[model samples]
Target: MSNSKLFILDDDRKTRDLLLAFLTYQGYDTTIVDNDVGFFDAPSPPPRTLITDLPTLLARMPNILKTGADNDLVVIAYDKAESARILPQDERWLFMPKPLNLDELESMVMRAQEYHALSSRNPDPPADEYPHFLCSTIIGKSRQMLHLFEMIEKVAESSATVLIQGESGTGKELAARAIHQLSGRSNRNFVPINCAAIPEDLLESELFGHVKGSFTGAYANRAGRFEIADKGTLFLDEIGDMKANLQVKLLRVLQTKEFEPVGSTRSQKVDVRIIAATNKNLEEQVANRDFREDLYYRLSVIPITMPPLRERREDIPLLISHFLGQFNRDKRRLVKGFSRESLEILCNYSWPGNVRELENLVERMVTIKESGFITPDDLPEKYLPTPSLAPSAPAGVSLPEPTGIEELPAAGICLNSAVDAFESRLIQLALARTGGNKKEAAALLNLKRTTLIEKLKKKNLQAS
Candidate 1:
């Protein structure tokens, strides 16, 4: 059986005792708290779930939230709309009504247990390709991430060119750096250039050096990214945006490793590893004659796709806690963590901007909240759950209603498409709640691990 603890809080000694006994019988190690003091004063907070009664819940709410939010603790309270309102709209405090049904409670706890398990088993970062170069700074425990880490390790030993693909904000640059760091060129410099960010006129000089007076206003000789990255790695970001003319020159470098400076007749020979990234479909660009097929093939010796934040919602809480820890240290603020409602809003929204967007959100919350706690009200309007869609209870708090999902908009999407979307969401939530452990997701959803694997495949998701 999984190792998880549950805390039962009730003013009535009888209710607390009853829960402790029943929960213990069902294989959960239980802790009992009867008053406001125990709720806040536990020397080392219990490892498992916090299940509390309404009266004790309200008396020490703000403090409970502050403590739990600060520490990454999960709070479960008997849901009453009025009672839930007293707590902040953060994701840490979960609510379900009292007069408990053992089955439903077990289900909820089971899901929570899986999340804890998955989160605890994070993968190691890949080794650097160059001796001193390290891998990515991202923190994630999702199966997808762990698998990606493994792939980075396997590919780092080779000299094959790498193509990193993903939407903006998904950290393609970080992934490319990780590959280079883990590869054979860790001691060498990793030069990066954004093809789309520079004008066509300047881009040529950026990749290949220009001698003094190569063109108008070319005052002195300047080395390009290729010259600087000699025997190192050159990271070409937004490769799809390169002009057709430049694509031919770039292709030659990949094939011959030889190029002349803009004005110099001397052909400079340089050995460098190339890593390229793009958010656009290179194949389509090739078909349109925008991107050269030869260049595409040369750059795609190995390919890695970074999943978007929305596709991996299971990592939201971890991301939140990680960000909070960072802000806490940087600001020296006592602000604990997100209220249950805040987390729910975060997980539900489609993060069109990916992880970068989430980082901005956290920074914004830190700047705005005067007190230590990050309340739901601090969230941007786009992230707030609509009143119609919002649960009657606070965020992270679940109601006793039969469905955990919100009803779909009637007119927008067809039922099958809706199911696909919901299934994707549910899998993400299960993964997020389980800290990215598919085994735990399977257990929570009461499916075989293999079944979860199939669903992931059907949804175009990677299972670690």
Candidate 2:
């Protein structure tokens, strides 16, 4: 009764009759293909399942699995001998020996129907939706993430400096690597240095290289990150932590594209693209006179802000699946997936540490559980939802009395307008309660930060 059709191309009259009669009785719109050539010229909408002999299937593979053809097409090939050796390694294919069993054939058909139904309802996104570099890393499908991908692609086409700002563990470094990988200089080196991790005294030497006898410990000439990253990208992680003296030196390099090694008067010129990342707000640091204002402007030529995981909770499932598969392969475990209840808990919980935290949790669970679905009981206590102790109305807040139907005017009112007013009032109250902090207000209202921002823009409402 479903819109799934079947095509049979067995050639022999008896085999074709049996297949057609059986499939038709099973509620399929069945067609009998007289020859391999007729199968190609059969119809407009291709058959959902194709039952054919091994010879005919192999002869028409180019037509059956042609580019732009229906990817959900299932092929059931049968032959006298074992044909698994000749069949393609596609999951949509199945092989059966000549003396076909009707029950098994029915089971295979039912499975193909189920696969078609599932795929039709929620098909996997096209591989080309995001850049190939981003496919393996920086996994996300949220609106914010998609927009971020577009920005990274655009930025990669140029050689301008990029500033990636986000909270810790939000994958700023991954974004930098993606930009570098997509750029023309990807074939060259992608040098990275953590400014905060290195000592202040030797940070300059590490960046600009050092000549032999430049300092007590300098035994031989060494190339810095800038020299090594020539014609490529240099990712300066935690750029905000760089000291004031280093900030001036870095600013000079950005302005001139040149720097002198430690204890060397000769200047070295290099074509290195700079990509800086920081967990701290550089604008605030500029105001505090902690970071150089000129350097901040120079580095933020192409600014990118990565949203926290809480703001894009829809991506939690995808991230979980990716990490699950990754850890499963690396640890040689067979952890199936998280239970529905456990997954709901994870999606709703506030991930303060972002993607890295989720990845770690998945890895830990996969390692411990080994080969089963992760249940709520298997999760850490912090990840579990706790009972709220606060009353519906918190201590300093007052709730407005509910309006009764009797208060309605005789002329009645617009339901949508009333709903909009109520929603706007709640948003205002949440903003006031959080002291204009949009992130906290979003949490208080049980909304994503981006969703809250969109609502504010739609309603043209300001913080109370």
Per-model CA lDDT versus the true structure: 0.73, 0.81
Q: Write one digit per residue (lDDT tens) for candidate 1, span 96-166.
A: 56566554465456545543554355555554322221253665667676667766766676676788999
* Pairs clashing within candidate 2: none
Best by TM-score: 2
lDDT of 1 at 335: 69
- Per-residue lDDT for 237-351 in model 2, tens only? 9999999999999989987899999999999999999999999999899879999877886787567999999889899999999999999999999999999999999997778
RMSD of each candidate? Answer: 24.7, 21.8
The TM-score obtained by model 1 is 0.56
Model 2, runs deviating above 4 Å: 1-135, 390-464
